[model samples]
Target: MKNAQKPDHMSLNSLVNRLKDGRYVIPDFQREFEWSPKDIQELVKSIFRDYYIGSLLLWKGKTENFDALSCEGIYGHQQNGGAEYIVLDGQQRLTAMYYAFHAPEIRLPNRANRAFYFINVDEFMRENFDDAFEYHYQSKRLQRLLDSPKAQYESHQFPLSVIGTGGWDLLKWVQGYTKFWEEYPNTEDDNEDHISAEQAEVYAVNGEQFGQYIKEITDEYQISYIELDQQLGIDKVCDIFTQVNSRGIRLDVFDLMNAMLKPKGIQLKQMYRDVMPNVDWVDTDRMNVYVLQVMSIVLQSYCSPKYLYFLLPGQLKPIRHSDGRREQEILVQSTDEFRDLWDKSVSSLVRSIEILKHPNEYGAISPKYLPYASILPVFAALESHIWTLPALERLDGTRKMKHWYWAAVFTNRYSGSVESTAARDHQDVQEWIADDDARPALLMEFENRMRNLDLSREVNTSSSTYTGIFNLLVLQGARDWISGVAPQFDDLDDHHIVPEAWSKKHLPGNTWHTILNRTPLTADTNRNVIRDRLPNQYLPEMFESSGEESMRSILASHFISSAAIEILMRRDFGPNDFEEFINERQRTITDAIQDLLIHERLDLSPRLRELDLDIERVELALRELVATNLEDDSERIPSGVRQKVQQRFEVAAKKDPSLDPENSRQMSSLLPHFDIRDIQDTLTNKILWPVFSSSFTSKSDLDLKFSQLASLRNGIRHSREVDDVTRMEGEASVLWFDKILTK
Candidate 1:
C-alpha cells in the first residue's frame, strides 16, 4: 500500500499544458469550481510571489475507477479522452489556475459575465500587488480597451491570454507594446499628449521585466503532487477519497482543536456557539478562531495558530519568570479551567466591542468601519486587564488605549502578519498605558507617516488609513444637513463633500474621491439634499434654512473650517476653489487627529516643511540672478561685496578643507548658505534691481518682507520661540516669494 503512491512534481508550464490537453480530470464527487475572480487573482499573486500553492493529490486514472466516479475535464478544458490523472484534492486551486492561465470565457462563480485577467505592468514594476492584478467582467468599455493595443500600451495593462499560448507570445507582445509607445509621438500632438523618449523607455523596460517574470514563474515554478497507482482497485480509491473528504469539507485548525478536546469533554464549537449571541455586535468572519486567539493571548501572550496548541488541556507551556528564568507549566489542566478561560475571553470581547461601537469612544459605527479586525483579540485581552487597574490608572490606561488604537490603524500596523504585531502591541500598549513616558513606538511612527501623508491620494476605501479617517469623521458627530442632528450610525453613508458628479465634469484631477473630500452623512441628506449638486448650489440653500451660523458649526463637525466654507461658497467656484477647499479641510482634519487621537498639539510640520521648500526657491532665485549676470559683467555684486564674500570664504576655507574655490558648481553651492539678508542685498542691488524688480513689488516692500522672513527663519532654524503673529507674517512673506520666484 505504501508503494501504491509516490510523490512527483511538475513545472507550472507542464501543468498548464496538461490542463489544456485534458490530461487531468476531476471526479464527480469533487465540488464544482467555486472560486471568485478575486480568489483567482490572489492565487496568481501567490504564484508570482513564489509562495507555496500547496500540493495536489492525483490518482492515476483507470477505466473502472472513471466509471465508478464519473470523471469530468477541468472547467474550460474542451479536449476529451486524454485523462491520465484524477484530482482527489486541491481541485479549487487547480481549477483557478486553469481559469487564469487558459483565459476561459466561462463566467466566474456566482458572477453574471465571463471574467478576463490582466497585469498592470506599471504597478507590477512598483510591486504593488494589491493593485497590479485585476479581473474585469465583460463590458463595452472594457471590450473597447481590450481591443485597442494603443490603449493597452498606454495603460500598461497586459492581457494574460498571451501567456496561455506559450513560447514567444509574451516576447512578441512586449515588443509590440514597446514599439507602440516609442512611436506614439508620430501619431499624437507632442505639445498636448507627448510621450517622452524617457517615458517610452520606462514602458519598454517594464514590459521586458514583466515578460521575464512570467517566463521564470511558468518554467521554473513547481507544483508537487502525490500520484496514486492506477493498479489500485476502485473500492480502495473510493475509500481513500472518502477518508480525505468527509462531510464535504476539510478540517481547519478549529475543527482539529475540537477533535483534540472531545476526549477531555470540552466542546469548543459549542462554547463558541454560546458566545456568538453575546458578540453579535463584533463582525468577524472567524469569530470562533478569534475566541481561541483571545484565550491564547490571555494565557501565553501569543495567538498564532502554532501557539494555540499550547492552550490545549495538559499541554506544556514554557513560562518566563521575573528573574529572566523559564519553567514549563501546563496551560490548561482540566476542561473546567479551559471553559473558564473561554468564558472570560467572551466577556472581555463583549466589553471591547461595546467600546469600539460607542460613538463617543472609538467610534467604529459598524464592523465595516473598523480599520482592522485582526487587532481585536489583543485589544480585548488588554481591555479586560486594563479595567482591573485602580480607578485613576484605569482612566489613564483607557485614554492611552485610544491613542494606541488610532496609531495602529493609521500606521497600518496590522496589515500583514497580525499575530506577532498583535502580541507586540499588546505588550507595548499595556506598558504605555501604565507609564506616560513609555509611549508605544507605533505612535512615533504614525506621527512621522502622517506628516508627509498625501491624504488626497487615499481614495481607496479598503485602505486602513482611509477607513480610520472615516471613523474619525463619524466621531465628530457629523450632523445631517437637513435635520442638523447626528444620524443613526447604520443610516450614515460616506458621501462626497465635493459632489463627484460635478467634479468629474469640471475638475481635471481625481482628488474629489479622496478621503479629504468625503465625510459621513445620512443617506437622506446625500440622496435628497446633495443629489448631484455643487456645494455652492446646495450649501447656501441649507444656510438660508438652517441659519448661516448654525450651518458653519455643522460643517465644522465634518472638518470644514470657515476658510474651506468660504471657498465652497464661491458662486464662481472652479478647480482652484475645489483645491483650496480640500486643502483647508485637510488641515482642519489633521489638526483634529493631532488633538484627539495623537494627544499632541497640531504642530506646524506641513507649514514648516513648506517654509523650508520656499526658502530654497529664494536661494535658487539668487543663484540664477548671480550666475546669469556673472559673465555679462553686470556688476550685480559690487567690488566691496565681492571682497566681503572672498574674505568670508577664506575664513570658511581655513575651517574646512573641502571648500573648492576653483570649481564653478561648488562656488555656486555657497549661494544657498547666504543668509536671507544677503539674498535681499543681492536682489536689491542698484545694478541687479531692474532684473529682480519685475519679480518683487519694490525695494522697500522687499526689505520689509525679507526682514520679517529673516527673523522667522532664524527662530525656526535655531529652535527659538516665534509668536503666532510673527509666524503669520512669515507665512505671507514665504507665499509672496514663492509666487514671484517660481514664476
Candidate 2:
C-alpha cells in the first residue's frame, strides 16, 4: 500500500533550491499568504535560537495529477513524471520564511508595500539574543538604519532578497572589503577621522566572519518535514492534514471546502471577494464567516448546529456493526449544485440588505450595530414570497417583516443558540406565509415580548441590541430635545439631560444614565452649547433666547411632557428640583416608547376594568387623599410640582379661552396644585386604609397590597409594559379593591 513513511530533515538551502526549480509547490486548498512581518520576524528569531518551529506536512503527488498554485516564492513549471511536494500544513510559516529570504517586495494586509532585511548581523550575534532580532517595514526607519555610520563600518543592513542567489556573493564581498582598505590605506592612527591599520585589519577579519555567518545561517540551518505517502486518497490526505494541524492555525471548514472545489477549478476565497463587494451592508472583515455560514444554512435546509464539523471532509462516517471500517458520506457532492446554491443565497442576501436600506423604512445606516446577522437568513427566506406579491401587497408584507425584524432585535430573539432559533424562526415564517391568521399572531407575539421593554433604567449605548433600539427610535421620528431638528443619523450624540456632574453632587448613587435622563443631541449642542450646567440654569436661558413657542416645540419633539416644559420655564427653578424633573421626563419617555413599539394609543382600560371598582369613586378617593395631605402644611408640596400643575391649568385654559378668567380664580383658591406623584403617595400610604379597610386583615397586609398597586400604577403611568408576574400582582390588587368597593 506504500503507507509506511518516516520524517525527513531538509536544509534551508536545499528547500530554496527546490523552490527555485518549482519542485516544491503549495496546494490549491491552502490559505493565501496571511502572515505579517512580525510573524516573519518571530520565525527568524526562532530559527536563530534553534527553537522548535512546527514540522511541515506535505502531500507527495505526481506532477501530472494536480496543478500547483504559483505563490510569491513558488512558481509553476513543467515536470517529467517527477514527484512534487504539496504543502498541506505549515503553509503560513513556509510562506513567511520563503518571502522573507527570497521575495524582493511583499504586499501587507492593507496592500501596503514592504521589504524585509536583517539589521546589524555582527552586532546581532554579539548582543542579547532577545534584542538582536530587529526587522522593519516602514520606509523612514529602514532608510535611517541603512544610512547609519554603524551600518557603514560594521557591514550591517543585509537585504534578504539577494542573499542565496547569484546577485550576492559572500566570497566576492570579503575580497571587495580587503581591496577597499588596501587601495585607500589609513596609516594616520587617528581615532575618529581616519581608520587605523589595526581597525582596518579588524574590519577585514569581521567581514570574513560575516561571510561565514551567512553561510551557516542559510546552508546549515535544518528544518524537519513529515512527507505523507504519495498514494493516499485526497480524503485521507485532508483528514491527516486536519489531525496534524490541531494545535496551531488549524484548517477551517472553508479551507476543506476550497480543497473540494479546487478539483473543479473553483476558488472559494475569490467567490467570497466577488460577492462581498456587492452586499453594501456587510462589514467584510467581521462578516465573512457569518456570510459563509448563512450560505451553508440555506443550501443545507436543515440547521447544522456544528456546521463546521459537518462540512469537514470525511467527518460523517456510516455506522459499523463490528465487522469492517465504514465509508464516510459526502455532505456536498456536485460543484454545479454548490455554485447554483451559492448564487441563490447571495441574491437573496443582497435583496434582504436592500429591504433594510429604505429611508422611511428600517433605515439601517450601518452594520456596526446590527443586533444579529442570523436575521439575514430569515429575511432571505421571506424574500421568496415577497417578490411574488403584488406591488402594494409587497409593500405591506415588507412592513410586517420589518416589524418582526425590529421585534426580534428588541427581544433578543437570536441571542444564545442562534442557529436553533434561526431554524425555528425559518419554519415559523414559512407557516406565517401559509396561513392568514399567522401574521397577526406573530405580531401579537412580538407585542407580547415588547411589553416587557422598560427603558426607565440606564441603557448601555455600546450594546448592539441597545444600539439597534436607538437607531429604531430615530427612524420612528425621534427629534433632538434641544434643537427641535431630526438628528443626523451619523452625527447624533447621547447627552445626559440631568448633567452627570450635578447628579454626582446632589444625588450620589442614583443612576444618571436612565432613558429619561438621556436624549439624542447634535454633537455641537452636546459638546459646545450645553457643557455641564444643570438643566434648571440652562433651560430657562434657552427659553428666553429661543422664545417660548420654539422652545416648546423643541421639548415636545423630545417627548418631554407639556407640563415638564412649563416647569422648566419657571424663574424660581432650583437645583434640588432636578429629581422631580427626571421622574416627569421618565414618564414622558416611557409613553413615547410605547407609541413607537405598537404604533397605537396604549389602552390600559381593559387592564384597569379587571379591578371592577367604581371609576368615579377611585378618582374622588385619590383627590380626597391629595387634598387632606396638603390641608395643613404649605411646605409639603414641592415648588416644582406646584408650578408644573399650575402651568398645565394655564395651558388648558389657553386652549379654551372662554374659561381663562375662571381658571385664574380656581388656581388662586387651590393651595397645592396636585400631580400624579401626590396621588400615588396617598394611595400607597396608611391614610388610604379606610378607603379599603374591608379587604385587608391587617395594616401591613393592606400596605403590601397598596405597595404592589403603587408599583403597577407607576409602571403603567411610565409606559413600561409589565411582565406576567407584575400583571398578576396588579390583578390581585384590583380584586382586593373590587371586594372593598362591593362591601
Candidate 3:
C-alpha cells in the first residue's frame, strides 16, 4: 500500500491507456467480485449524477497469484511499460462499465437494481458519436465551450459514460455536487457544501431530497471515465476494481451474464440484450440477487469455472477467485443443460414443497435442505412423464427414498459451492461424483423405496431428501431453458412470486431455503423486478402514476399465469397490498405447481380459496379417543369449551364424510400418497420451525404482534364472517388455519 513515485498525469495517463487493451484482463489470482444490486444502483447514480468518481491507483509489482479471472471486462494493457498491469482502485466500476457499455442493452440479472439502462448504440454510432457533435459536458452550468471537434475530443477523457440511465444518473449526481461546492463553498457541510438552504429552497438543489436533484446534475455533467492505462493485466486491474469506483453500486445476475457471455455469438448477445429481459411468470424484484448467486454458479461451469461468482460487479456474487474464464465456459454449458430440465425441475420442486408440509423437511439429519432448491423436483417430475394428465402410478420401492430429494440437494450444492474455486473445478467435480458415496448409497435406497406401489402417497415437503432432489431438477431445468436462446447459460436470475420479506417475516429463516427464495428469470427482467414491493397484478410506475389502462394492461400481460391474475381479482383489494400479496401468492404458487407438474393430478382451484374455512369433523366413535390428548377431562378443559367442541363436531359430521362414518380416521388412511414416514421426515426437517409474528398467539391475536399480520388476519377473518358465498376447504388451507389457531 505504499505510495509510488508520482509521474506526471500525462505519463500515468499514457500507461493507463495501454493497460486497458483487451489482453490485459485481470490475472488468475485476485479477490472475488463482491457487490449487490443496491450497490450497483448507487454506482450508476453516482457516476450519472456527476459526483466525483474516485481515481484508479496502481503500484508496480507482481503480487501473489490466487486463482484465475476472465479475460473479458478488463482491457489489456501493453507489458512494455511494466511486467504486470497494476490496479490501484476503481476495479468494480471499470469492469461493470466496460461490459455494460459495450452491450447494447444490459439488464441487471439480480432481482434487484436490474432495470437501469446502459446506453445502446449501433457499432458505427458507438465509435463515432462523439465526432458528430459539439459534445458538451455542462458543469456548474459549465458547457464544454466547444469551438471544434478537436476541442471537444481533447478536452478530457473519452466520453466513456454512455448517455443512459446508469451513466447519465451518475454524471448528474457528481456534477451537481461539484457545481454546488464550486459556486458556494463554505455555505454548509462538506458533501453538501457550496449551497445554502435558502438557495435550495428557491432552485431546489437539495441534497438528493427531490428527484429533481438527479435531473439537475444529469442536465449538466456527462460521465468522464479516465483510464490511466489499458495495458495492465487483470491482476493489477482488479486491484483498482477493488478500490475506488462508485461506493455502493455493483453488478447483479444480468451483469454476470453480460460478463461471461461477452464473446459468445451475436444471437447470444441479442438474446442477452433483448429476450433475457422478459422471463415468463417470474418476479425479478424479489429474487434477483439470489438468482444471480445461482447463475454465477451455473455460468462458472463454462467460461470461468473457479471464479465465475467473482464476476459479479459488487456484493452478493459468491465466487472467491480471479482467473476463471475456462471454468465459466463449463458452467455456461451446464447451465444450459439445467435450463433444458425446466419441467422436471419444477415438478421436483413442487413435490419437495409438499414434503415440507410433513414437518420433517428440516429434521436434524438433513437440516441443510431448503425448499428453494426443490424446484429440481419439478424437472424430475417432468422427466418421469409426470407433466402429463396422470402421474406415474408407482416407481420401484427403495429404502432411503432419496430419489425425490436429489434435485433439491443438487440445487443447494450448486448455489453454495460455485463461488469456491476448488468446489467448482472440473477435477473436484469428477472426484465428487466418484467419491461421494454417502449420497450414492442413499440414492440406491431411495429408488428401492420409490418402486413400491404407493400411488396415493401424498408428497412430503419437510424431507430434506425431497427438497434436495427438487433443486437438482430446478438446476437442470434452468440449464435447459437458456440453451437455445441464451449461450453458455447466461443472464438468468431468480424471481420471487412474493417478495422475500414474506418468508423472512412469516417464517423462521431456518425454515427458508436460499434456493426456495428464487426462480430463474432473464437478467434484464430481473432488474425490472427490483424489489417486488408492489403486487405483481398491478405494477406501479416508478416515476408517473398509473392510470386505469396501465393497471389493466399490467395485470393482463405481466401476470402471465392465468391463475395469478384470477387470484388478484379474487382478493378484490388494493389497500395495504402486502396482505393481498401473501394471499395472491398462495394462488400463484399452487397454480404454477399444478400447471407445471401436470401429473400430480392436483386441483389448483381448492388452493385459491382461503384455508381457514376447512374443518375436520370429529367422529362420534373416535371423539372420546381423539379428545384424550386434550383432557384431564374437566381438570384441563372448561365445561363451556368442551360443550362447544362437541357441538362443532356434531355439526361438521352432518355433511362431512370424515365424520359421517364410524371410523372416519380409518377411512382417511386409505388415500393414495407417498410413504408416511417420508412425509413425516420432510415436515420435521422443514416445517417444524415456521415462525409467526404471533408465535404463541392465535390468528385473531396475530395482529397485536405486527401491524401487517394484524390487519391481514382481521381483513380475511372478518370478510369471511360477513360473506354470503359458500366455501370449500382444502388441506393446505386447513394446515394454515391449524397453525393460526394453535400458535
Candidate 4:
C-alpha cells in the first residue's frame, strides 16, 4: 500500500529560480536553519564554478507541515500537488544563495577581517598577478578579471575557490572573488574526482558568477539532480544537518536550547542566554560541551517539537517556535522551575568535575546535567523541611517537580518502569517512612551499596572521571565545583598539555576515548601544549604566542604539581600513549544508577533490583580479597617487573589519582602474573625480559603497576632492556600490601 516510485527532475534554472523567489521552504517541523553566511557563500561559489558535484534536496509534498522556525528566509515552497519535495540537506548552502544574490550586506558575529578570497590558479592567471591587488586581499594572487571577463574567461583554465569574510573584510574578498570565478573550468566526461579536457574548458568559462554568469552556467553545463523520497520530514532534516556539518560550523544545542526557551517569553529567554554563559569554566574556556547536552535534556523535559521553543539571545523572535501564545505558556510554565533547579545544580557540578579532572571520561556526559542532582538543594533552599521523609511524604505539590526531573535524565538512563512515579507512590503508600524500622535498614543498605559502586566506577581507569565528580560532591561537600580544585599537578594532561602542535595523529578509531591521553588542564593551557611536545627543561619565562601567564604561574606554584611536570618532561613524546587509549567507561553504570535514583525513581524498580543483587556479590568478593593473606614463599615476584609496573601506574595516577582504582587489593587484581621463564636479566630497569610469575598472593596488584604494564604490553616501541630487581620489589610490595589489608 505504497505510492509508486518516480524520478522527478528539475534543472539548475528552475531550482535556483524557485529558491530565489522564496517558492520553497524547509518546513515548520524542520530543525532551525544554522549556517554562517561565509560558509553558505563558499558553497554558492562552488555551484557557479561547476564543481564535479551533483544533487539538491527536494521534499515531495503539497503544503506539508514543517517547523515554523525553519520556514524563515527560505526559497518559496510550491503547492502544485504532484510530489513536491522539501529541501532537506542543502539548507545552509541554499541560504547562501539568498545572501549572495539578494542581501546587500551579510550579518555575522565573532568573524574578524578574514576577507573573502578568490584565486584563479590557471596557467594564464600566472601573469595577470598584481602586487597591489595581492596586498589588498592579503593574498599573493591576480585580481582584475572582472574588468575583462570575456578575455580572462576564454584564457584561464583553473579551479576556483571563493572565501567570504565575516565582516567588512568581505568587501575586499568579494572583489577578489569576482576576479577568481571569472575564468571557468571545462566539463569532465569522466569520473567526478578525475580531471578531463572537456571539464577544463567548461570551468574556465562558467566558473565565476555575476547575474550573467548564472545564466551562462545554466545554459552550457549545470543541471540540478533533485533527489526525492517519501520519508522526508523534520527529523530527517535535522539528522542530515548534523551529519554534513563540522564542529563549530553548525547550530549548537545552546542556540537550540535558547530557541526552545523562547516559548517562555523573549525576556526570560534573553535573560537565561545572557546569564547562562557567564561561567568562567564553560564559555571563556571554550570547553565543556556537556553544558550544551544539559540544555537539550532540560528542553526535552518541557515540550516537544510542535509546542516547545527556545529564545536565543540577539534574535528578535523565538528561535524554536513561531506561535507566541503557546510558546509563552510553555515558557512561563517551565522557566521558574528550571532556573531554581539549575542555579544550585551547576554550582555543585562545576566543583565536582574540576576536582575529578577527567575530560576523557566525562566527555560524553554533559556538565549542564550536573545541576539536575541539585534539585535537592533547590528544594532545601526553597522550603527547608523538604529534606525529611515525613515532610516529603506529605508533599503532593512537588509531584510536577519530580515529573520534570524524571523525564530529563531518568528516562534516558534506565530500561525499566520501576523508577517511574507510580512506583515511588506505591512505596510511599506502603509506609516506608523514617520512623519505620524498614526505612533505616533500607537507607543503610542503599548508602553502603552506593559508596562501593562510587569508589569502584568513578576512579576506575576506564571511566570518565567527569561522571565520578558527583561522588566528590557527596563525600566532600564543596560549595563550588572548582573551589576545592587542586593545582594542575601536570600529572594528568587534559590532553595535548604542551598545547600547540601540527595535528593529532589519526587513529582509525575514536581518539577521544583514551583517558591516559585526556587531561584536566584549561583549554588555554591544553591548546597551548598540544600532543607531541617534549617538555622543555623549563617552561619558558614567557610563552610568546598566547602571551598567557598560566605557564609561569603553574611552574612556580606547588611542589607536588611541579614534580609532575618533571615526569612528563623525561617521558617520551607521542600522542598515542597507552593513556589515551581508554576503554572502560565504567562510570556509565553508576551514572545510570544515580540518574535513576534522582529522576525517575519509581520507574527504575526492576533495574534497581538488578543493581542491588549484582552490587552485593561484588561487595562480598572484594571484602574477601581484602581479607586474604598475601605472604608467598613459593615464588618471589622479580623486582624488575614490579618496579616497571609500579612506575606506569604511578605515571597515570599522577595525571589523575581519582581515576586510579581504589585500594591496594583493587590495584593488585589487574596485574599480569609472572613466571621464571618470563624473567630475563637486563640493564637499568628500562627494558625487561618477559616473565610470567607463577604464584602471587595479591588479587589484582598487577593492574596498578605502571612500569610492568606498559613494558610488557606488546607494542612497536623503543625501550632500554630492564632488570629483575625492581620488578620483584613491585610484585612483593603488592603482595605485602594485600596481606596487610586482609589481616
Per-prediction CA RMSD (Å): 12.7, 23.5, 24.3, 23.3
Report model 3's TM-score to 2 decimal places.
0.22
- Residues 1-743 of candidate 3 have per-residue lDDT tens digits of 54333442322223223334432345434333454434544454445434444444444343332123422235312223223434444455555544333322333443332222221112112222212122222333222322232222222222323232254544564355334433443355553535454543333232233334334544454433334444356555555555544454433444545555454421223443343343212323422232333333333332222243443333233333567533222332444453343323333433433443322222111223344331322222322332232222222111112332332232233332222222223233232233332233222233333333121121244444344333332322332121223212244454553455554665544333332333444665445544545233323332135454544443322222444444434443343343444444334443433232211211112332233223312112123322333232322333333344444444444434345434323313211111222222222222222322223334433223223322332333222221212232233333453454443
Query: How would the candidate models be sorted by TM-score, starting from the highest?
Result: 1, 2, 4, 3
- Tens digit per residue, CA lDDT, model 4, 124-211: 1332222101111212333444344343344432212221212233233433434444333324443344544555444434333332
User: Model 3 off-target regions past 4 Å?
Assistant: 1-88, 91-249, 264-269, 280-615, 619-743
Sort by lDDT, top down from the best: 1, 2, 4, 3
Candidate 4, overall lDDT?
Answer: 0.36
Candidates 1 and 3, the one with greater TM-score: 1
**CA shift of 171, model 3, Å:** 46
Clashing pairs in 1: none
lDDT of 2 by residue, 519-573 (tens): 6778888878888976677887787888878877777766677787766556665
Clashes of 2: 0
Where in model 1 is the C-alpha error above 4 Å?
1-87, 90-236, 239-250, 318-327, 434-437, 508-510, 600-743
Query: How does each model score on lDDT?
Result: 0.78, 0.59, 0.34, 0.36
Candidate 4 TM-score over all chains jointly: 0.25
Candidate 4 lowest-lDDT run of ten: 129-138
Per-residue lDDT for 64 in model 1? Answer: 77
TM-score of each: 0.57, 0.44, 0.22, 0.25
Tens digit per residue, CA lDDT, model 1, 495-582: 9988888889987778788999888888988998799888889998999988999999998888889999889889998998888887
